[model samples]
Target: MKVQQLQNAVEAFDFDINSDEHIPELGRLIADKQVVFVKQKLTEERHYDILDSWGSPGMSPVIAGIGLGKLKGLHWNAVRNTTARIGKLIDPRHRSRMQSVTFQKDHKGRALGIFTNGKLGWHSDQPSFESAQRVVGLASVEASEGSQTTFLSTAECYDNLNCEDRSQVDELMCVNRWDMISKNVFDHFAGELIEEQHAIMRYNGCPLDGLTAPLKGQTASGVPGIHFPGSLFGYFLGMSVDESKKYIKHIWSLMDKPEYIYTHNWKDGEVCYMDQAITLHARPTSVDEGDMRRMWRCSGYLDKLYPGQGPMTMKINVEGEEITWDELFKRVDEVRKAEYNRTKWSKIFHKMP
Candidate 1:
């Protein structure tokens, strides 16, 4: 195995994924570098194996059905055309589970065929959940030109903050609400919210009430950093929403410093792994419809480092009996089919203004 620094804080390695030492060595590298980039083409089985070695495989409520014929994990089919339509037409409750990021356009040069809006705001993955993801891995199957992913280390950002600022933020907790942050995006695509379908679209049993998480959390190696993700909807628990926005914006200014940021231009066969809990990432809106940008993404938790916080567990009332996570999914799948069958054409056409 050969390892080298891709940037000041990101490392790139040429190592055998099947080797016995791969997991420990990669874990150490992830500790030292907030993100690690490796150049290798991994098969689906190998991909899941690497993710499983890190922690329990995370299941996205949105992509649960996508993995029907595949393995039993959160598998996202993030093709450009499919994701674009799903983002707009799918119910918000279900849309949240569709967490793949893509920027694809059609031959007409219009933005109608992409899932996430261009230039996704800087954010860590799933901060609204009680147990935010710790590690995220993305492998490029097809690379897009003029597209880059930018990352900022929250640990580094926190270190750069003045002592007084750090002290104030350290004492606070932030409320993360998926609905508030995503409201405009969803509204832009899906029009007004569908009140009746709201309850069915939840992901991993996370409540719509939102999560109250500490502003600072420790990495696996005990490095402390800001844990809040970049979303318009969060607020410092005791502060007014406006006050929280001002404070978060101040932090964003600090993080925007060039020294704390790294940009990676995607190359096919490259796999990038990030410690999502301590890092924020964003992508520019550069892909046109003809651009071929496809990536396979997998994320997992590091329970030992940030334990008792994630792998959200919830009990669902199923015919008067509480069911487990697996059982609940089965019930959800059945309901999803019924709903789709009932409103297939209307849901698709209703998104058109």
Candidate 2:
């Protein structure tokens, strides 16, 4: 494949994207370049097949276990079937698209995708999870005219930090939760969310609730970078939400510099893959409702780099204490059950009145 640089990202030209021979090179390009774009027409099935070559598609079983149900002790086929059904029940349109990426609504007005006409905030895909997807791929199903997706290389940002800043970032932990409207990312710059956007926020926030991870993440090659979840960020581990905002914004400033950023204008029959572990991407431009901007998006680990490492676990920082993922999952479960009970009771009381 012929390659050329596109600002901070790289663009590949003239290659068989679907060939197994090119898959390794494609994976390496995404890792080294952080973002690699290619103009190639791909079907919905082809888009998903390319991602499957990288690793397991859709949500990592580790995160899915918390939302869908425990995936332990299930056969591989059974697990896939179970998750597919449960995932569909959670969001029907998303399930139809392989539960990989969001899309726009159809003529029937049924929410076909979570991504509507709005400017998305800067962040990696699903950074709230301990085992967040390592790579993200987006294909232009319908060219996103009049909109651009900007990407920033956090790995480069981390490398440029001074000794003190680097040390600080390494030791820091940040809390991420999606259940709260206050943490809604789409509203980062925009005003109040419309009902559809609010629903999207809830789904995005539910999978990895009240979890903490190091502010720094590493590429599979061991290059360190910022693990920013954008507006989904709740707070730092030891700092109050108000206190954490100062630091979060400060760090965000460093990454947003032009030297580390690239903005891509989409075209029909174009596909791009980005290293989610080492990059933050944004949609700074707004899309009108009538625009035919749609993409087939996928995020997962690259099998060549992260093989057979499903159902991964990590140590989570809570307050000043460190806890196992299992403990955190249990705590989240209890809180969810309690919240469900309160809502249930409130509904019953309203009927009585």
Candidate 3:
């Protein structure tokens, strides 16, 4: 493979996500490259805003950190604490109750995968929560020694699509269901609330005027970040098996350009964050199938900013600050207080006539 280079060892949109000190804004580098490489260095906080929009159609959950970087050196409890921090940073509407899941080889009797032969097909994260999730986080707790992440940007695919294709699929929304029992999605971000009652399709935030929905993406910068996930929209449009397959293949090809893809080769002790609207992430499985790979996923969204940004907020780095596990645990406990019990309620009960 012809490894693309950048000025003075600082590369943007590189497939390899690793230890370095350069962060590149990819919107400017879309000339010949489709992806941006964000080399990681230990910092006090994370970068906010990507050319202004919180959602992304290119690569998601705006990636950062590697199992080998920031995550590698920390204790498992510390990692869990950091993961908890991610949950707190999400929007309140969706974060009302968040699920914490660990992706590990032990669960599968070996390794688990989001991409590869036995994995789910190309997909966006979290399609089933009543409270839409905007940002998603993944840390390589035990990433197979040579494993890395491959991100596909849907923005480029949306742009290259023909008018007819766009029209037919534009208004279509996806029913993103998470089959946790099947391993397609985890239970933490997949299940419905007590009030939702075994529901499958997530809510569509599209305006009453039939404007674009969250999954359809907005047309602000004049660049259509993405159409809809082909599987979901194809059914709505009544697309033929062959026809949909062709378009899906075409879009997949466009996203494969080295310039458009950010391959994250992890080093111990790092983390990555990306805009979910624009990003799609996956990774290869282990060759041995006997090695243990442990990872933790915590997410938030930009639409769901720290102070109730929406379901779209994924991670907040505490502005490069550090807090002990005990401190983090106390904060989490405070948020999900056990004081809501009936006995506690009667202490200050006020009944109406």
Candidate 4:
């Protein structure tokens, strides 16, 4: 296996990803470099295998469990069987959200994947919530031409800051909300707020008010870096509305530097892993030939990292009360169950095999 440096990423060529001996080295590369690309073909099951080796599978509620049916307005058990009917359920791990980003639709004209045709803004998955994934991996499946996934490492951006800006960033707090996130991050994109998307978020238990620290741990390395969720940003904590706007502009100007950015034009069968704590990514263009392109995505914490060093450890507040990450998810699960029973889709779908 050989490795080379891209502008702000590390590319591993001829690497034996399936070999157990190489897993530790690959884990190190992902931790230190924050972004690593391996040019190799991977099936959906294999994609989950690599991520699972690192830690727990970071399942997005919207894409997993009860939220899956809720998001599509279908019955949960029905969707599960529909997924299985299309193909055999090869493994139990497949039950976790191994999201496919595609425009293709099923026979009933339902989209086969999420974010089928849109320009995704600068953001991290689950940015507003404290339960952000530690690492995210994407495997290119088919026809990924004319599209690019761009990434920016806040760790690099933080290192570039002057002492004054760095100090201010450390002391500052950021407020993130689902309601105003689209307007702040995707001002240029049409239809900023998709109501169905927000409804799914609510069903999955994402809070409206998410309090975050501007500077937090970047990776398992435990180095401090800016946690800049530009998309989900509502305002800085304890700042006036007007003052927050001005301050955000100033902060973004510093973090969104050209030197810290890397844009990848994907090739088929390639996989990219990103350390979520330190980085922000975006799909810079809308899918014109959406049916032709597909990618598999999974995110979760890395096992190689020290315990308590993951995103779940971040100090975050919901509403006004501070709670443990597990506690938050438990509460959300309860709400999801209530909605599932209330909707009666549970009965319809679960009644099937």
Which number leads on TM-score?
2
For each candidate in turn, the TM-score is 0.67, 0.81, 0.44, 0.80
Clashing pairs in 2: 54-303, 103-113, 178-205
Global CA lDDT computed for model 4? 0.66
Off by over 4 Å in 4: 61-92, 182-206, 211-214, 310-316, 325-353
- Model 1 Cα lDDT, one tens digit per residue, 222-302: 677887645534577778989988988887687687787778887777778887667877665444444567665667765
Candidate order by decreasing lDDT: 4, 2, 1, 3
RMSD of each: 8.5, 5.1, 14.0, 5.9
In order, candidate lDDTs are 0.57, 0.66, 0.36, 0.66
> How far in Å is the alpha carbon of 190 misplaced in model 3?
15
Model 2 TM-score is: 0.81
Error of 1 at 151 (Å): 0.9
Tens-digit per-residue lDDT, 270-349, candidate 2: 88888877688877877656565767666677754566433254555554467775775566556555666787789999
Worst 10 residues of 4 by lDDT: 189-198
Model 4, residue pairs in steric clash: 54-303
lDDT of 3: 0.36
Expressed as tens digits, the lDDT of each residue in 88-182 for candidate 4 is: 22245564646676766667655556556667777666666555677888888888877799988777778878888888787776777656655
